[model samples]
Target chain A: MPTLIKHDKIMEDDWAIVEVEAPADGIRRIVPLEAWLPESGDGLLLQGECEPDARYCVAPLIAINFLVFSDGRGLSLAVLLRSRFDFTGELRAVGDVHPDLLYYLNRCGFDSYLMPDERSAQTALSTLAPYTDYYQASVLEPNPAHRRTRRFA
Target chain B: MYRYDSFDQKFVDERVVHYRAQTERYLAGELPEDEFLQLRLRNGLYIQRLAPMLRVAVPYGILDSRQLRTLAHIARHYDRGYGHLSTRQNVQFNWPELAEVPDILQDLAEVQMHAIQTSGSCIRNITTDQFAGVSEDESVDPRPYCELIRQWSTSHPEFDWLPRKFKIAVTGASVDRAAVDVHDIGLVVFRTDSDEIQFDVKVGGGLGRTPVIGQMIRRGLPVRHLLTYLEAILRVYNRYGRRDNKYKARIKILVRAMTADGFRDKVDAEWAHLEGSPSTLTDEDLARMQAHFQPYPYDSQPASIDTLGSQRLEECAFDAWVRHNVAPHKQPGYAIVTLSTKLTGVPPGDVSDVQMDLVADWADRYGFGEIRISHEQNFVLPDVRFEQLFELWQQATSAQLGANNVGLLSDMICCPGGDYCSLANAKSIPLAEAIQRKFDSYDYQHDLGPLDLNISGCMNACGHHHVGHIGILGVDKKGAEFYQVSLGGHAGNGASLGQIIGPSFSRKDVPDTIETILQVYLDLRHEDEPFLLCFRRVGMDPFKERVYANPD
Candidate 1:
């Protein structure tokens, strides 16, 4: 079983991640976006290049697939999915995730991460929220530092 | 200069702590080398030819006296006693231990500075005219917008890991002093007839393997929509930019592949969706940022012009320094003074710790306690009193900062080539020094008039060789070093790329080749026309003929 970090804490994950061609018959399995029908209540898995559309907005969980940690297209996709499409469910990051990338992944609105192992999951938790404040607006904070904090001058 | 408030200060402090942790993890072997490379690059540390080179962001080229002292302290205490000023208005330390970079970042943060996003595949330090607020030709000061962009781009979540490095430049002056056309995103800020601030946005212009001028994607965009529009552009680039080949990954390649109109359509589509989001600048937001850049309290009384005129008449060196280095300021009694770093023997932008301290002291005594670094590798005192020009010039001459060559040929922009950069194909500083030695006479340089001589180690064009009036590019021929020369390039108003003269030259023959080209210009030029104008009027044929003709 893979380690999971949900809401910034290590936890045992029960949701199943199905591949694009894999059969996902149950509601607990997060099927690929192509496989998940609108009527089916199964969660959707989105690739980095997937079009962020409103059709998949009703999914209970959307796990963004990253082929490599350095490919940042999925980060922007998550931002658009949350801020523009108003996807208010569990946003998870899966595949090729590393502890070094957790801080940026969290900032871009990943609420859950499927880590490689237990030790890496702990490292990921430590790196998250390294900075209490940030300058720009994102999915986590709609208001930037200038709008949220009281400036001296 | 924009002062960092409590909110901004705290953000930078937290960043230093975060970077420190990252460095520790890498050292402990918990982080992989490939992953650590990206993390360290985001903090502006690059593993170079000989050692690690640390680049500190100057933030639109503006620095205060305190920040200058801090940089000097870093130079004295860290890996070296000297630092090199980059063409992007930032400073680079040639040698810094990788383990000690966090300490350097901590020192910089104490002065409200950081190296965040300086040299990663992300947004770089925003640059503008060195004489931003004081220049007489500009209607609006570009610093406030530059600050806004700087904050927005710092540690930006989605755009931090782009396919290639991105650079943005802003200019508000009638003349393009910031070299906006060569940046990833070039913004020309101006005011409408009704006193409304607006921006003309250009996209996908850069200098690297492929040096293409940026295209104007939008015109007369209101100031409030700046961030949203920028976000739209970045998002489009992040999603669609090439990831296969590093050389073809810049946004310019994408823009070229899609064509300007097609790329503009894509950007417009993206912008239309997010034009009025939470990122839109509010009236209060605009006012607050504008307040930070209000005009300095200049002396209202007119400077003593007769005294200055008498001093100039008395000393020919003072007159020449004033004629070449001083620029007109918006305020009547003030002047913008450029401290030339290109003193004959020294590498173009290299400055010692002592020189940094001296410049800081001069900034406090002669004008406001503020300094600026220009893209042409020179320091600028933004608010010098016209009456005190003679005194400052005399002091600067002894200090080697007063070279009486601001835009002249010897004040060339040369990059740290094979000496410091691992990516360089050939050495550049030696060629620059040889040329400077040949053209040592002030009378000859003054008679020759304004010329932009740029040199780069390789096709990366860090020295902006493509836009130089006389561009020299270092090339590698069968593992041996060779020099390629280009002519007729200019970076002002209507910027144009230079054309290669003929063939490559040996290192020993570069200076004489340049002399031959200049001789052609001198022989053909009418009266007092500048080198660029003369070259433009008479095409590259005459110069090419003169140089390549049998030199028996």
Candidate 2:
């Protein structure tokens, strides 16, 4: 089982990732987006160049798989899911996830990061709070610095 | 200049702390090299061929004397006692220890400056005209908008990790001194007939291997919609921009692949969702930013001064410097002075620590204690008195900053090619030196009349060679350094890319080839016609014929 950082705490991932979709048998199975049915109530795994759809928000968890860490398309996908589609379920970042990209992943509304190891997850947790203020409106904070600060007024 | 408030200052300070931890982690071998490269790049640290180069943001070229002094201090202590002024109006220190960059950034933060977003695949520094507020032919000051864009783009959640690097340039003048058309995003600020400020938004222009002029996506967009509209464009790009091949990843390629009309429609569709969001600027927000850039207090002196006339009549060198390096100011007796960094033997934009300190002192003594770094890689003292021109000129010439070649052929914008950059195909400085030495005559160069000769080491085009009146690109031919020359590229008004001449030349032959091209221009030019006008009139056929006519 992979150790993941969720909600700023490290824990063993409980959900099982299955290649084939199954009719929800009351088991926590994460299936591919194409195979998962909305009625099954199973978590969805989004990979490759998939665009954000509000239809995917029905899943209990939506894990975005970054094929390559440097490919930033997943970050935008997460932001659109949270900011535009208002996805309230658990958002997890899996595959190519590392400590270096965790801060951005968290800011873009990823509530869970599936780490390669427990050590990497610990490093990601340690360096997560380097900033308290940000200039742009993020999924973490809908109001930007200008909207909240009185200096511009 | 917009002073950093509590929030802004805190943000930069936090960046220093964060970057310090990243550097420590990288040194400790916990972070992978590839991942650390991206992290370091976003913090404005680049692993160059020789040493790590640190780029500090100038915030649209505006710098106070105190900031300049801190830059000098950084150069003296952390670097090799000099810094290079990049074409984007930022200062880059060529040599800094990888571990010591945090200390350097800390020093920069003390003076309300930071290296954030100066590099990497993020929204880089926002740049504007060096003489934004003080120039005579200005419609509005672009600094406030530049500051606004700078803040909005800093650590932007979704857009920071883009497909490729992005650049934004703003210009408020009727004359496009900021080279907005060649940037990733260009904003032309103007006032409506009813005196309401608006922006003409241009998108997808860049100068790399594929140089495309920006297309105007929206005209007369209200000032309040600037941030939201930019967010819309960036969101569209972040989602759709190509990421498979790094070479084909710039927004220019995406815009070209999607077609300009198609891309604009997509942006409009995205913008509809973010138009009135909390990120939208209010009237108070605009006013607050504007208050920081109000006109400087000026002494009511007569428009014309007899001493300036007498000084011009007395010293021919001072007369030449004033004609070339000094520009008309909005205030009557004031002038905008460009301190030329393109001395004959020195690298074009490299300034030593002693020179930096001296220029900072001059900035305080000559103008308001403010300085501007021109994208042409020169220092501009924004508010010099006309009467004090002669005294300033004498001191400046002694310091090697008065090169009287502001727009002349010798004022070439050459990048630190193979000499410093690992990405460069050839050593550009030697070629620049050879050409400068070949065209050493001031009278001959002045006769050429306002030519932009830009050189780049590689296809990355950091030197913006694509838009030069005479563009020289260093190419690797069969593992040896060779050169390609192009003609008639312009960056202002009606911007156009240069057309490549017939073939490549050896490094030794580049200077002679430039001279032959100039000979063609001189023979074909009408009286008082500049190089670009002459080249545009005669076309590239004649110049191509003469240069290749006597092929050795």
Candidate 3:
């Protein structure tokens, strides 16, 4: 079974994201972007937008829902977020993260990738570090220009 | 040669380790054969009929003296002291042990090289004209764009698991030396009236079970939009390309099914969505990449060849070689020389360790220490001084590099067929050898004039038999090897697939069949009209009748 990480665990802060079965009366807390960020919330959780608009409320963490493992909409979204918006905030990738996709995801600039398990997450880290030099720059390493001189080194 | 930076080094080192583990897992039987094949193929390791063949990426065929030396060292130390230059402008070692491939890859990585993406359904080596940066007729050096495409395609996520292998060829020259017309995606870099560089994109062209000439989908696509456009095409192919039958999975089949117009619409729609996306190349990025491919330091010398005429006349062999092998360079006093490897008794494209080292030394001594491997399976010294041509020819001759049959009938492009390749239907190397033996005389070859005799073991067309003036395809008749002859194929500006002549001939009769076809060509020529033109004029009827008239 694929593991799921709530948006709260991804952030360095102590915030938890729980699914609301029902909306209660009085609680001063952050809500899902769909509920709170449409008009006023300063952040957004882009679910399936591969090419999201740069003019968002706040730094978006594109979520990858487990519709299909082969459906690579999240990758396009991550690349779009990095190349278009120049979004510097934590571009965390979440859900059904295949081990093979980790290298590309990291290159596309997903600092934190949410794999199905801790083992897979660890594997992702190792996989991302497999190659030391790349001819081209990705979101994570945006300066392939500097890497050319160091290609042999 | 673009030197790798620290990040590039780190990436390759990391990749080595990653592949090491993968290799280990495979050896440990942790990974299944089918799954591991994809992973191994991406690293350019292929399990052949006799042993594993490891293909090393040459990166648009651009290699420095140092890289060539490294290849020589690998050839001497690793395999059978010989390497085969492949059609994709890469080098292949035919007999590397499966267990030793990691070590071989590590050796390659030491020289800032890797066999990454040389095969598999993922993006293969991004190729361009061997004369990319130095050609006189070039509008722009296509290497930077080729490099850019290389980066974007390397380890790409969504497109890695494609329906079949994808190839992209780029050309900036008016003449398509890179054979762009017969690739999955052919990009021709051109400048508009406004002096803005743009790409004329062609799609769906390929060779194999089906031979296709790519259809142009977009014209005047600005340079900055290269990656975005490529992404659009890949996305379209990835999503809709066939997966049920491997044989029917190439983009050519998909393009045929959708029709060119329909496929273009699909790609355009995808591009529309990706217009302002991150994948969209920026001017800054293009500029930076362009900086890496700036023209080499060239000496200020007279461009005219008035002084070299007397020296060339002194040596008839040298004159013949110069006429056939030498190409005009963009820079003055320099010429692009193709060192043919199609010597009799040697497999086409096979270069020995000694030859590789000698070529490297020559590159450093005579030219700009850089070399290129042409898709027609020949090594090119892109910047040789015209005055030094005779001297270079002498050294090349001593080293057996001076075949003097560059574009001649004997200069065959052949693939390692049934002898090495598991996929081959018949032995192609022997056929090539037979043809080479028959046309051993340089005088005879020169008289025949600029004929391409290409042979492939199978329909894969790795030998590029479809584009040859005299094409020979190896076919299996029950358990016997048979050769099918074709004529009028050209891979230049006027590109066309070869037409099959008649029935397949037995191994013993193949050479005689080719001889008959040539005799017919010699008999039916109009003055100095080349083999292609004569074949076109006379049509295949004369040649076909002659070839099949005395069939064994």
| Among all candidates shown, the one with the greatest DockQ | 1
On the 0 to 100 scale, the lDDT of residue B403 in model 1 is: 94
- Candidate 1 chain B — worst ten consecutive residues by lDDT sum? B302-311
B229 Cα displacement, candidate 2 (Å):
0.9
State, as a TM-score between 0 and 1, how close model 1 is to the true structure.
Answer: 0.98
After the best TM-score superposition of candidate 3, give how far the Cα of residue B349 lies from its true spot, in angstroms: 0.4
lDDT of 1 by residue, B85-166 (tens): 9999999998888899999999999999999888989999999999999999998899999999999998899999898999
In order, the candidates keep a fraction of the true contacts of 0.80, 0.65, 0.38
**How close is each model in CA RMSD to the real structure?**
1.7, 1.8, 5.7
Cα shift from native, residue B274, model 3 (Å): 1.6
- Report the Cα lDDT for residue B489, model 2: 94
The fnat score for candidate 3 comes to 0.38
**CAPRI class assigned to model 1:** medium
Two-way TM-score contest, 2 vs 3, winner: 2
Chain A accuracy of model 1 expressed as TM-score = 0.90
Task: Give the higher-DockQ candidate: 1 or 2.
Answer: 1
Off by over 4 Å in 1: A20-27
